[model samples]
Target: MIWKELKKQWRFMDGVVIASLVVLSFVPLVVFSMNHKENSAKEGNIAIISIDGEEVDRFVLNEETKHKEKTYYPGKDKYNIVEMEGTKIRVKEDNSPDQIAVRTSWISKPGQTSICLPHKLVIEIVSGKSSDEKEEDDDMIITY
Candidate 1:
């Protein structure tokens, strides 16, 4: 009896609705899939250090780079020591009281940043980008 009642109400529109729903569920799969470009041999990762919103130093990050340390003076008697080695960069030491940037160590990927707000300094990592392309993506929001 239940089967007979269901057959009486079901129509062509019901099949259409079910089919459309199935198709709509797959739309996200096609829409959200992204193609990632492999890093080019000619281009390598770079780290940029800035003081008071101006770039002060830039370094190519890779295993070939020598282990080095550079100190930046952002204000009177205030300094930040940045270290780079083997494709990784970090704030080795700083005069800031909280020592937050110093504690966050070894950033080695695109979009990673180490900021010393008190000293008005920033270090940002960029991957496979030219100068112009880097400027455009400065405001990009990277989500997990």
Candidate 2:
């Protein structure tokens, strides 16, 4: 009688093992399908344009460009530091009368140019081209 009960329990256990194997086989397939769907919906095209004086650089970014900001260190000359925004720019200056012009244009959108410079640096912005000679004596310009 005990032998008959053991045989009956083994029959039910065999079915449970087969059911688990079937469920396990479907798990990887489900995961792969979801991953494929997500990858297909991702964006793959983006571009960034950078220009410094006469030099131009262009490249692509994997993400969208809702907004962007860039700072350029032309050199240690303090007069070369520039910040650009969309087509607008601002340049820093010391007490130099050299004509420095910065032009920025986006390749993706042509016909848009931005010019930026310190108010004191622009010849038209300032009256009679006066220099900020006192600025050189400020505490900010002096270093220990």
Candidate 3:
């Protein structure tokens, strides 16, 4: 019935446009799925902890990872507590008022992230690199 109504009000060009838009919508899904698969295939996922845009620590998210919490001091009296265990990580506590990162709970996927703007802290999960890949990237530079 909907198609019949559309047919009466629409022309061939309209149908072509709608079909093109529908196909276009799936293009991004396909692209993102491919990228996700590539990242998820890494041997182990890694959680990167950054404060003020500099990486301070990284933890391998795997079954053997110990259950522990670490406190980071980004600035004077500004701190964030991160906890990790069994392939999952989270911001357990922080000095930020909003507590958004803490409420984000645990993140286990490669692309998940938690940010605390007030503390300038960020925790992100990323795909792990093999030894050869790590060696190749060792030359990457950092600036002051």
Candidate 4:
């Protein structure tokens, strides 16, 4: 007798319960999609083009030299530059390991003082050409 009474109550509430669950599930999916879109849009390009017309795809700043060199001081943050034939991309620091595709025009021209990219801006430049063709050829000569 008690079982039948409880079953009747549950049957009447079934529609409401299912509707609530469906709404709950939908909320998270919506939130997740929005979050993913925001994250994807934030990723930026990382590259460096020297004033001397030299393009370096992969570069690592000597930590010691970086500390001493105030000219290329990257402030407190860490960054990397990905150098291509015609463009240089700047990648900001983040914990996540992901590549950002950035398409930006060059702002600093050759023969300009303080032209070297900050040491913190280390980036991996992708090249399709042969190794010899992808040499670090820059017109700006580094004088010590």
lDDT (Cα atoms) of all candidates against the true structure: 0.85, 0.39, 0.88, 0.38
Worst 10 residues of 2 by lDDT: 121-130
TM-score, cand. 3 vs. native: 0.64
RMSD of 3: 6.5
Whichever of 1 and 3 has more lDDT, that candidate is 3
How many collisions between residues are there in candidate 2?
Answer: 0
Model 1 residue 53 CA deviation in Å: 0.4
Best by TM-score: 3
TM-score computed on alpha carbons, candidate 1: 0.63
What is candidate 2's TM-score against the reference?
0.25
TM-score (all chains, Cα) for each model: 0.63, 0.25, 0.64, 0.25
For model 1, what is the error of residue 120's alpha carbon versus the real structure, in angstroms, after optimal superposition? 0.7
lDDT by residue (13-51, candidate 3, tens digit) is 998999999999999999998886665554669999998
Ranking, TM-score, top scorer first: 3, 1, 4, 2
* Per-residue alpha-carbon lDDT of candidate 1 for residues 44-110, written as tens digits (9 for 90 to 100): 6789999999999999986688999998889999999999987889999999999989998889877
Q: Which stretches of candidate 2 lie over 4 Å from their true place?
A: 1-10, 44-144
- Which parts of model 1 are misplaced by more than 4 Å? 1-42, 131-144
